[model samples]
Target: MSSQVIENHRANAEIYSGAPICIEKSRQLLDEISMPKGLLPLDDLVEVGYNRAAGFVWLRQSKSKQHRFNRIGKTVSYDKEVTAFVENRRMKKLTGVKSKELLIWVTISEIFIDESNPDSITFASSTGISRTFPVSAFELEEDGKK
Candidate 1:
C-alpha cells in the first residue's frame, strides 16, 4: 500500500460514520498501513481505543486520524508500541467502590488466574510490569475506552 492508499482510506472513512475499520481490508491495505520506515514510536500513538465486544482496536496518530484493527488474543504482531499502549491502558487504578482493580481491553490469554486460588490472577504488561490481584478486583470494560 502506498501513502496515497492510506490517504484514500482515511478519506473514505471520514465520509461515512467513522465506524470501526478492519485491519484486514486486504493484503494491500495491510502493506500500506504498516510502518513505512521503522517501528511506530510509542509517542506517535496519540489515541488508542479498544472495543472488547467487537474485538477491535482503534489506533490514531498524533494528528487524531484513526484506524482500527482486529485484535489478536495472543501476543500482538507488528509493533510492541501498540502492545505496550494496550497494556498500560488495561490497568485501571483502584476506585473507592471497587475493591478489585479493573483491566480494560485485554484478551483472555493475556491474563492468568491461579488455579489454586481462584481469587488470584496474574497480569503482565508488554513493558514488563507484572502483578497479582484478586479476580473480583478486575473487570473488562471496552467501550470507547482509551
Candidate 2:
C-alpha cells in the first residue's frame, strides 16, 4: 500500500481509538503534516506511532501547535526498520524484566495473529497417543474454579 494510505489509517485509528481510516484521507493528512516550516522533523516535533498489518498501515501522532508542520511520512520499507528496532531493543543490556515481559507479550500476540482460526482441538504425538485438549478446555477449567 502507498505511504499516504498508511498515514491516514494511523490518523483515523488514533483519533477514534482503532477505527479504520481510508488511504485517501491518510494521504491528505500525511501531505499536510510533512510540510517543513521553521526546523525539526515532524515526527520529532510530535510523538509519532505506527502499526503495519500486511498491506495496511496505521499511524498516529500527538497534536501540537506545529501540527501543520508535522510531516507524517511513511517508510519505503517498514519490515527492515521494524526488525532492526526490535533487534536493537532486544540487545539492550539494560532491559531485564521489562524486556522479558515484552518478548513474552509480543510472542503471544504473534502466535494469536498467526494462528488465526485455530481448531478447537489439537492432536499430540506420543507413545500412548494421549487425548488432546482444546483452548476451550482450559477456559472451562478456569470458569469452573471461579
Candidate 3:
C-alpha cells in the first residue's frame, strides 16, 4: 500500500514495528483469520498493522522475497509491502503477492476456507482461476507453536 494509505490506516490501528514483533503479529493475524500460520512467510518484516474497524491489514518488509514452498512445490513472491482485507476464515482483495505456475506468475486475489471443506484452503487468482490445497501444507511447525 502507498504511504498515504498507510498513514491513514495508522490512525487507531494496532501497529507493530520491527521483525520480532512484526513476525509475531503477522502470525497472530493468520491464526485469528483461520489461515495457516506460515501462509505469509515474509522476510525481515519492518512493520505490521491492522485496523479492526476497516478489517484492513498490511505488512511491510525490507525487500521482496521469493519462497518455494517445498510441500506444494510452488514458488510464491512477496513484494515489499502486502495488504489485504481480512475476516474470519477469509482474506480478500490481497495485493503485493503472487504465485508462479509453469511459466506465469499469477496475482493472487483471495484466500478462504470453505465451511463445508474445513481441511482445505482455496487460493483464487485475479484471473478467477483457483486451486485448493490441504490446510496443513501451509502450517508452520515452529517452536512454541502446536
lDDT for each of the candidates? 0.30, 0.24, 0.90
Candidate 1 Cα deviation (angstroms), residue 86: 14
By the TM-score metric, which is better: model 1 or model 2?
1
Q: State the displacement of the C-alpha of residue 106, model 2, in Å, after optimal TM-score superposition.
A: 7.8
Query: Lowest-scoring 10 consecutive residues by lDDT in candidate 3?
Result: 137-146
**Residue pairs in clash, model 2:** 8-26, 10-59, 33-70, 33-71, 34-71
TM-score of model 1 (CA atoms): 0.23
For residues 1-146, write the lDDT of model 1, one tens digit per residue: 22332343343242211223222221112123221111121234433344333233334433322222222122222222122112222322211111112544332223344456655655654444555654433222232242
Report RMSD for candidate 1: 15.2
Candidate 3 lDDT over residue span 42-106, tens digit each: 85999999999999899999999998888889899999988888999999998888999899999
Off by over 4 Å in 1: 1-81, 84-110, 124-130, 140-146
Worst ten-residue run, lDDT, model 2?
80-89
The digit string of per-residue lDDT tens for model 2 on 68-139 reads 211222111111111000111011111111101223311111101014434332222222232222333322
Candidate 2 Cα lDDT to native: 0.24
Give me the runs in candidate 2 sitting further than 4 Å from their true place: 1-54, 63-146
Q: Which of the predicted structures, 1 or 3, would earn the higher lDDT when compared with the native?
A: 3
After aligning candidate 1 to the native by TM-score, how far in Å is the CA of 128 from where it should be?
8.5
Runs of candidate 3 exceeding 4 Å displacement: 143-146
